[model samples]
Target chain A: MIKLTYRDAVRRALADALRADENVIFFGEDVAEAGGVFKVTPGLYEEFGGERVMDTPISEEAFIGAALGAAITGMRPVAELMFADFVPVAMDQIANQIAKYRYMSGGQFIVPLTIRAAQGAGAGFGTQHSQCVESWLLNIPGIKIVVPGTVKDMYGLLRTAIDDNNPVIVLEHKVLYNYAEEIDEAELTHVPLGKAAVRRVGKDITVVATQLMMHRSLDAAERLAGEGIDCEVIDLRTMIPLDEETILESIAKTGRLVIVEEAPHAGGWGADIAALAADKGIYWLDAPVKRVNMGGALIAYSPPLEDEVVPNVSRIADAIRAVMRA
Target chain B: MTQNGIALPAQMRQDMLKKMLEIRAAEERIQGLFLENLVRGTTHLCIGQEACSVGVAAVLQPGDTMTCTYRGHGHALAMGMTMKALMAEMMGKASGACKGKGGSMHMTDASIGLLGANAIVGAQLPIAVGAALTSRLKKTGNITVTFFGEGAANIGAFHESLNLAAIWKLPVLFICENNLYGEYSVWSKTTPVRDIAVRASSYGIPGIVVDGQDAECVYHEVSAMAERARRGEGPALIELKTYRFRGHSRTDQAPYRPKGELEEWLKRDPILILKERMIADGQLDETEFEELRESIDRQVVEVVEWAKTEPYPPVEALYEDIYYEG
Candidate 1:
């Protein structure tokens, strides 16, 4: 077993993907020699050489579009959007082109590509660089979305995403980059998507989250255990092929639900989960589904302001306690 | 022929003329279908841009890939997408190019190397670059081509794609069929510069302008650059100075066109230019040209009749082709 950070896990997965298949190529702004703006893709350029590992100009639409173009031609391209906030700049390619290519083309083209982007707040990237824009992408069909919360998931899910026969977006939370754990080499297996991981098992209330929120929810579950809350935390691995069965089954056992997400409460992934419970698991729910979200305001530059909006351990625990009372 | 000093046989010229005629006939039939309210949604016809399509397709080898914009009927037909499939797609039949999922705007056939046609302006540029990158990475001596309009030059994707393709020395030909208008606005109003080809200089790649009305000229220009690109000499932007005889879509009457502009372009019509050239050289007589046009017209009529009998996709189709199962 070896200790690895979430960042290291992602980089390891990338190196492995490139090594395993000659068809896989990586490119984005400062991703090659500069090692990416966040230092997540260093040494890949030297190891893979310039031909395979490329550095592109700051053109999100082009590079992202290039990923689509390259994928359709039987090349597996891992394109980094640098920050998820910059998705709007290339929204045309992501939502309209890459996602719709297979459906609109009558399945004539199989876009075997992965687009990795650093997302979520807590690093003080301010409003422009630290936003989580999954809602913008989740709305688009013909695309798969994967959010790996821990080092294990970061290693496993990325490997799965790279080999998937569709355009998959692998969103790496900026806050979890330094999160580390001990993992065996064999444990770096391809984790199938659409399966939720039960982080903590309990029976009182079901706590659902993804990315950083999953970690925070687990922390909340640990703290709430002392107060006899007995929370079951579920980590949603892939957002698109949502593991409804897992979430619903947990809701059934617990008879209550609290969704904590690192996004706005309105029209966010949390809302979708809440709706899912309302639609199918309403009979099992002992209380109205609670949502612990960052609300609709933009993340501020100051630490306190940012913390106030982002869902944390305390917020998640409070929500679980509130749901327990219900 | 003039620039590359390549000799063109009378039969090859006649074949090119036949393809151009086929596109012209299909477009005319599509317009008729639109008038009859048989076509679904909107339709963009490349009536006057036939030469650009024929020229670029002629330059591309069998395995070479190409992508075009929404106004891509001419390019699709020239690149070997069947008239039946295209007509069926326009009429929303199950046997359409995209199984009626994509109407006129998203025509695609991967088997013939057409990645797909894009609806959003300038979306296909990066995709073409990516395909070129695939050629470079796989060491395939094939060139990729992308067709866009003059208005696409002002978009960010166009600039980014040119820059990336140039820096990577990927084998691609950026074909800008300057059809004089974007949708409703004239080209001069949207663009600051006169020549779209000059923008290619920013990336230090060769940019050339060809008479878009002359299929032979466009063929000569694209062929020269395509060969050099196959040799890994980087990318080139070829501006085919063409015009659209009809409105951007079936709905518009093209009242925005300047006085006598349509007349001037029609006088140098791509099909007529070839027909007259061939006639002057005694390659084909007036009766022979009419016979060729009549054959294509009859084929288009048969496609429309067959497509009308074809049923729409089943309800289950809505849930299918959204993702590729591995």
Candidate 2:
């Protein structure tokens, strides 16, 4: 076992993939010599040289679309979008081209592509740079969505995503770059997508979260445990092809649910989870499912205002209490 | 007929004429089927842009790939997609090129390296660049060509893709079929420059303008650009001056075009000009040209009848092909 930061784990995973397969190439703005804005891809350019780790012009649509084209031809490309907030600029390529090519081509093509982007709003990067837009990609078919909260998951999910035969979006929270944890070397080798990890087990309310919210919820759960209120937390590793069975089973046991997310409450991934419980596990629920999320407003630049707009540990704890009380 | 001051072989010249006629005949047949309500959804026909499709396709090797816009019937035919599959696809049949899922606008055949025919304007630019990146990374010596309209040249994707292609030295050719109209708006209203190829100078890559109605001219220009790309000289942009003889979609009457403009363009029809040049040069007789047209017309008619009898995809097909199950 060894310790590693989330950023280092990601860099190691990318370097490993590049070494394992010559077809795997990394391309994005400032990824080569600059080593990425977040430093997640540090030393890749020096290690693999420019051809394998390329620095592209600040053209998200072009690079993203080019990554899709490269995937269809014969290479596994990992494209970094810098920030998830800027994904809308390349929505046509993501939603229409990358997501539809396989089905549209009648199984003739496979897009072994991974798009890595920093999401969530705690760093005071303002509206454009700080936002969790994973919901925008949830409805898109043919693309898998992965949000890794731990160092082990960051390494394993990235490796798995690189090896997968479809387009996968890896949403790394901006704040998690410095977050470090102990890792089992074997666990870091492979963490299959589409599986939920049970962080805590309890008989009270069930709290489901992703990305940054997962860590916040775990913190909230620990506090609640001291208050004689036990909360079971599940980190939803992948949003698409969601681990519904795990969530439903947890709901069946707890009979109450609290969904925490960084995106706006309306049309967020929380709604999808709430709907799933409402539709199939209605009889299992003792109370209406509660969703804790950011309100519908542009993320402000001020530190306090940004903090107020995004979900926090207290907000998740409050939602868990409300659902349990109901 | 001469191409680039060199006489093209009789067989090559004859094949070009045959391909152009096939596209024209198929498009005309599709118009009739659309009027009869046989084809579901909408189709953007390439009735008058046959030269641009055939000219560029004529230079592509077996491994070379190409992508196009919604008006891609001519491009698909030029790339050697079977009439039976394309016709079935327009009719939404199980035996279609995309198993009836892509319909007319998204026609694709990966076997022949027809990546896809995107409906979104300028979406295929980066995709083609990506293919080129793959070719360069793997040292495959293959090239990719993407076709779009004048309006797409003004899009952010076009500029970004061209810039990246030049900086990375990717093997791609960007072909702009400047047909003077974008949906209902004239080119002058939307574009700032008279020649879209001049925009390529900003990227430090070679750019040229050609007579789109002259198949020989388009062939010569694209062949040179493609050769440069394959030799690792980076990307180039070619703008073909042409006109669309039909409406943008099935419902459009094209009332926005200037009076007498259609008649003038019709006089310089690409198919007619090629046929006349071949006859005048004694490479083909007038009777032989007529027979060639008749043969293509007969093939298109048979394919339409065959498509009518084919079945729609099964209900299970809807859930399949979204991801690579393996």
Candidate 3:
């Protein structure tokens, strides 16, 4: 058993992939000598040398596009955007090029590329730096999205994402970088994508969460257990090819659903999940699905103001209770 | 034939003329097919820009790769893409280059190293750089050529990709086909610089301007740049002064162009210029040139006929090829 922070687990997984495949290379702004801004890729540059680990010139569009180009031509590149909020600057490459190339090319090219970006707003990094924009990428087809909530998942999912023969976006929550957990090395393995993990199995209500919200939902579930409210929490690991089967099965078992996400409530993936439950599992539901998410406002730098915007443990618990009451 | 200091054997000159004729005939057929409602989606034609595609692509070896913008039929045909597959793709047939998924703008054939053509203006620039990066990392001595229009020079990716390619000394050739207009707007209206190649100086890389209507001129300039790239000298940008005879899309008639502009460019048509040069050099007689055109016209007609009868992709294929299972 080894205890590691989410940041270190990511670093370890990246290092492992680099060591395993010579075709793997890492590049981003300050990702080389300075490690990453969040320290998620520390020591990789020194270990792999400059040829494998590179620091780019703060050009997200070019570097991300370059990653896709490299992927199609016999290289596995792990490119990082310092924050997810900046994705719009390079959205054309992400949404139009990387997401469509595989299908557009008639499967002639496989984009074995992984794009790692920091997401979420608990750090009070302001609107430009703290926005959770995973929902913006949810509609883009031919790209896989992974949001790991635990240190183990961070390691496993990063490894799996690097191995994927298509473009995969890893949305690492900025707040979860420092969060640590004990991971059994023997049990550590490739966590398959498009599958959800049941964090806590219960019968009263089902709670679906992702990334930072998954931990908060689990914390809320633990607290609710004392109040005789058994909440079944399912951590949605991957977002694009969503684990609809797992979610629907959980809803079938619990008869009620609550979704917790950090992105804005409007047009968010939470809404997609709520719609799925409504459309396919409506007959199985005991109440209208509740969505706990950020309000439709720019994330502020002030801790108190930001707290008012983002979903927290209490917000998740209250939503759970509300859904149960309904 | 000798033109712009580029002297080639009679056979090679004849082949070049044949290639340009093939592109011209194919595009003409496509225009007719589109008018007849055979093609499902709109197409961006490359009628007047044949020299830029043939000239730049002629310099590439078998392993060398290239990517282009939506107006990429000339580029694709010059890179050795078959007329049958391209015509089928435009008609959205099952046996098309991209299995009917990419339509006209996204045709690709990786076997000959034609990295998929991009619909987004400057999206392929960074991807070409990435392919160059792969060559550098693998010590594969391969080079990548990326083609974009004058409008793409204004995109942030152009600057970013040039900067990265310069710093890393990646083996890439940036070919800018300055085809006068960006869709409906004149190039001058969008860019401050009169010459797009001059912008390459910002990245400390060599930039050259060539007469894009002369295939021999483009071939000579791109050949020199490709030699520099293969020898590990880094990236270079070549701006081909060219024109597009047709509207941006099938639906547009280009009312924005000034009076006499199209006529003035039509006088310097790339195929006509090449044919005249070949005839002047005594490499081909007028009758021989006419015979070559008739042969290509016949081949294009057969390919289009075969494509029209091809089947559409099955509905079940919608869920496949998004990811590589292997």
Candidate 4:
């Protein structure tokens, strides 16, 4: 068993990919010598050299588009956008071009591209810097959305993303990078896209969480367990081809559902999943599916204001209790 | 190589003029069809900009790649994409290059190395740079050309793609078809610079401005640049000074263009200059020119009729091309 931080797991995945394939390359602003602003790509430039790991100009659209073009021509390119907020500048290329190429071209072309961006609100980065914009990307079709909550999922899902013959958006929670977990190196296997993992199984209430919220959900589950409320927790590793079956099965077993998310409550992936449950798994629910999500506002710079904006373990616990009571 | 103008062979000159006239006449026909509502959807006619496409395309090898913007019918046609395919694409028929899914803005024919056309301004620049990079990496000896307008020169993509091309010495020709307008707006009102070509010098590469109304002048410069690219000498920035005679799309007469400027540019009509010069040089007589026009007209009519007879894409095609075979 190897103990690694979420960031280390990601670094390991990238290292493995670079070592395994010569065509795999990476480029982004301050990604080379700086080893990525978040240190997710640390030591890669030294091992692979500039030809494989390059520092690009501050042009998100171009570098991302370059990644797409490279991927189409048999290179597995991992493009790092400094922040998730900057992804909007390259949305047309990602959403309109990368996502639609395989389908639009009738399978004549394949975009084996992976776009990695640091997401979530932490470190007091103001409104612009602090945003959980994974929901926006989730709305786009034809691309897989991978949101890794743990070091294990980070290592596994990223490897799977690089290998997938489709465009994949890997949204890393900024807050979870330093979070450590002991994982078996051999067992730290690549998880298939669209599959969810049952983090903590229970029968009282089902808690669906992703990214940072998954940790919070687990904490809430422990707190609820002390209060004699056995809450089932499911980590939605991939959001797009969401493991609806796992979520609905948990809901069916528990007969209660509480969805937790760090992004704003309105129009988040939680709502999409809740709608799916409402429309398809209505008979399986014991009560109305409760959604414990961040308040509708931008994540503020001040610690207090930021704390007020995002959902916490207490809120999730309260939501699960409310759903259990109902 | 100097930025000074180069001489053109008589044969090459005649061919350039003929290509320019073909694009000019075809664009005029497209405009007529659009105005009569026969060509459904929006059409970005490159009427006065024939010299740009003809000039750049004249330099390309059969296997070289090219990418363009929404105003790409001229590029596609000049690169030998059949008028039938383009017209069928405009008419939303299965015979279209992308089988009617791409429409006008997303035309693609990878068989001829026409990678694709993007509607987003400056988007294709990076893709072209990447394509050139791939060619160099694989030692394919094939170059890539991307066409954009003067407005795109100021975009972050233009700077990034150009810098990458220059730094890597990639065989990329950044063809700026400076048509004075981006959509219904004029670049003079938006851009601070008088000439977009001047910006290329900042990237440590040669930037040249050619008379976009004279096809032979534009062609000679592009041919030299293409030759330079084949020798791995590096990328070039060629700005073709031209004007858009039609509206940005099918509708909306451009109210932004000044009356005197429009009339002055119209006086330098590329088709007329080519026709007159060809007759004056005795390379083509009036009778031969008239016969050629009739032949082209007949070809256009036949293509449109053939396209009309083709069936629309099946409904199942919607789910067909979204991913490659696993």
For this target, which candidate reaches the highest lDDT against the unseen true structure? 2
The reply for model 1, stretches above 4 Å from the true place, is B1-7
Q: Each candidate's lDDT (Cα)? A: 0.90, 0.91, 0.90, 0.83
**Regions of candidate 3 where Cα sits further than 4 Å from its true position:** B1-3
Name the weakest run of 10 consecutive residues (lDDT summed) in model 3 chain A: A181-190
lDDT of 2 by residue, B111-222 (tens): 9999999988999999999998989988989999999999898789899999999998989999999999998899999988889989989999988988898888888888
lDDT of 4 by residue, B91-169 (tens): 7777788888888787788878788888778888888887887777777788899999888887788998898889888
Clash count per candidate: 0, 0, 0, 3
Error of 2 at B12 (Å): 0.9
Write model 3 residue lDDT over A136-235, tens digit each, in one string. Answer: 9988888989999888898899999999898999999889999988867865677898989999999999999988888889999999999899999999
Model 3: per-residue lDDT, tens digit, B1-326? 12367577777777788899999999999999987899866799999988889888788898899989888888899999999889999998999989988988997999999998998888899999999999999888899999999999988888999999999999999999898898889988888888988888999998988999998888887888899999999999999998889998998899999999999999999889888888888788889888989999999999999998999999988877877777
Indicate the DockQ of the complex predicted as candidate 4: 0.53
Please state the CAPRI-style docking class of candidate 1: high
Q: What tens-digit string does per-residue lDDT give for candidate 1 at B145-189? A: 999999888888899999989888989999999887888988888
Candidate 1 residue B226 C-alpha distance from true site, Å? 0.9
lDDT of 1 by residue, A146-165 (tens): 99998999999999999999
Q: What pairs collide in candidate 2?
A: none
